[model samples]
Target: MPLSARRLVLIAAACILVGILAGRFLFEGLILAAAGIAVLAVALSYGPGSRWFSPVTWVVCVAGTLWTAATAGYWMSVSAAADAAQEVPAVASTLFYIGVGGLVIMAGGVVTAAVLRTLGVRRISSAGG
Candidate 1:
């Protein structure tokens, strides 16, 4: 995998770890991890320039973004409820941050790749020219 993909995978793995250890939000973590793994696999097999890579990323990105937004909305509603508890689980906060962080990593990877290419920094490319 390219460096960008590898870094994103690491972030995804962290999300899985957070869910497992926290015993909460496992579904969300698994979704992010699976998407990350798929992205990495697609990038490696077809190369970043191949037609398959961007579509895979787009599908996963959209799904993950929607899921994250729904989760955030649910959290907001619960916190706003009349009977809402005063204290929130620390793990819940961590998991939320990790999910958002994974998204950021994905986006950052794309931007980094584009910037590097634009700047003639293909040395970081998997081809290693």
Candidate 2:
């Protein structure tokens, strides 16, 4: 796999970890740890001749993105609903920021992948230099 492909995969996996952590309401340390594992998995999968073209991989990537976005939406909605009860703005603000970040990441990944695929990849000759 190319570096770009690897990075893409890692990003997708990271989204998955974020989704899982958010849904589980895990502590910060565990969430970070899970995200790290996802990043490592993605990076390690990036090697020449690696079978990264499976349909299941694509399914997982798409599902992960959707899951992340949905999870973010859930958190944001809950926070908004509780705004009347809590005087502290920090909690709601932080949750909103995280949700926005997740949405941005998901959108960026989809757009980037689509653009790259539509443009297509070309090979450069290594024998010249």
Candidate 3:
């Protein structure tokens, strides 16, 4: 299931669409949607990369994807209601803040995990040796 360039572009378009549905601001949805895609990519690669990641990491990726998707759906509904009422809900800002905060923490964890994993890998042997 190698992704082609065209497929990647289409995926990016879809992410933007999902992002539009997920946030009060485009950046927020972009963040969450991008993160969701990242997690999905990791989960999909579990077979060949199994040794590099623990089972827990895989579980987290799957769970995170589910949570992010569900929240995006909620965000869509909120937009619908707000549109119908012709006024933004007072709580919408709070929702954005919580979403951004959680994404920041999750992003930090991802960076830290990647750093640790890279450090744990053994150095390659020189061809001359």
Candidate 4:
């Protein structure tokens, strides 16, 4: 597949994921969606031969992952407080789980990207030269 086509597919997938997340978590979902879009944009902006360990890419991935983790922590705390107060909503507990899942996924992605970059991995073109 061409790089452009692959990028388009990735963008489409990100949009779909964000939409689903937003539908489930409202404001939190929107925030996460924005983060996802930002990451995609950064990835797309790189040249085909760009180094994976580019400082900008690393910074974006690290920052985004940390942000997601912080948000997840907040949600967990809220759920715990509500539970203690006997006012816990089922939705709150569900959101907490979702947040944790997002955090894990994002963190894993960042780590994978970092490792790939450190190993000097490059994009493999599908079209045989």
Candidate 5:
């Protein structure tokens, strides 16, 4: 894909917004938040033109989103189990489910992103040729 100034700005804006949201929920300390912002800023700065950005973005996005989902799932499961069985098995179940679900979600996200990227490449190639 052709890297345009407009696209770069849009990607930067998106990365900044996502980084802020991730920081708000995932980070407990100011340093971590700052790190997140810095990482995102770099991603945005290099994304539009860099060959590595698309894959890196896809990997990070998929991993981050799945991590978020997994943590959320684990908390929810633990809450439900604590309310229900009050047993060690229930706690284990909660952990297992959360871990498995997170993995599945992460893999799914990667596959989905790969498909989208493939389609994008196809479209661009078709347009050019």
Candidate 6:
């Protein structure tokens, strides 16, 4: 199937929802892990020449990484604060890990996309020269 901006957005949204919902379940960690893997797979599926690697893609990836990181930090802080009064919820921990994993995967996807673009450019230049 062809990858488009709308599709990517939808995939990201779905992954986010999955992570949030799965955090409340027994298999939270496993479900979040699966979501992280799926996000990475979707990001990697885009080719260098595809619009999936456009400037908007970089913006989205960077924004997503930052958002996830910030969210993870916030959750960690809340967990720490709760340690004195009560045990932290499993959902909070699950969300924190999911955020971290998502951040890493998104950043990696951006770097990989840039590398692929560079390699494609080099290949084209060498072939034409």
lDDT of each: 0.51, 0.48, 0.53, 0.54, 0.51, 0.59
lDDT of 4 by residue, 9-72 (tens): 4874686597567858565665556456545634533322434335545555565555555555
Number of clashing residue pairs, candidate 6: 0
Give the clashing pairs for model 3.
none
| Root-mean-square deviation of every model | 10.9, 9.9, 6.6, 9.8, 9.4, 9.0
Q: TM-score: which is higher, 1 or 4?
A: 4
Off by over 4 Å in 4: 1-12, 15-38, 41-49, 86-129
Q: Ten-residue segment with the worst summed lDDT in candidate 1? A: 41-50
What is the Cα-based TM-score of model 1?
0.39
Residues 1-129 of candidate 1: C-alpha lDDT, one tens digit per residue: 456666766766675566455545334554444454434433333235424345545644654564466455445544555257556655556656655665665555555545544554455554685
> Candidate 5's C-alpha lDDT?
0.51
Better of 2 and 6 by lDDT: 6
Off by over 4 Å in 6: 1-84
Error of 6 at 54 (Å): 4.3
| TM-score of every candidate relative to the true structure | 0.39, 0.35, 0.46, 0.41, 0.38, 0.44
List model 6 lDDT by residue over 19-91, tens digit each: 7677777444435544554455455545555455555355545556554555655566665767677766656
Q: Tell me the number of clashing residue pairs for each predicted model.
A: 0, 1, 0, 0, 0, 0
List model 3 lDDT by residue over 1-129, tens digit each: 234423644575677568768756563675566554655444333322336455545544654554565455457657677779866565655666655654554454455555554554433234334
User: Ten residues in a row with the worst lDDT in model 2?
Assistant: 40-49
Better candidate number, 1 or 2, judged by TM-score: 1
lDDT of 6 at 23: 72
Model 2 stretches with alpha carbons more than 4 Å out: 9-51, 86-129
Tell me the tens digit of each residue's lDDT in model 5 across 19-104: 56775665433223333433333344233334646654555455545455555455566656677976534555665665566455
Error of 2 at 127 (Å): 32
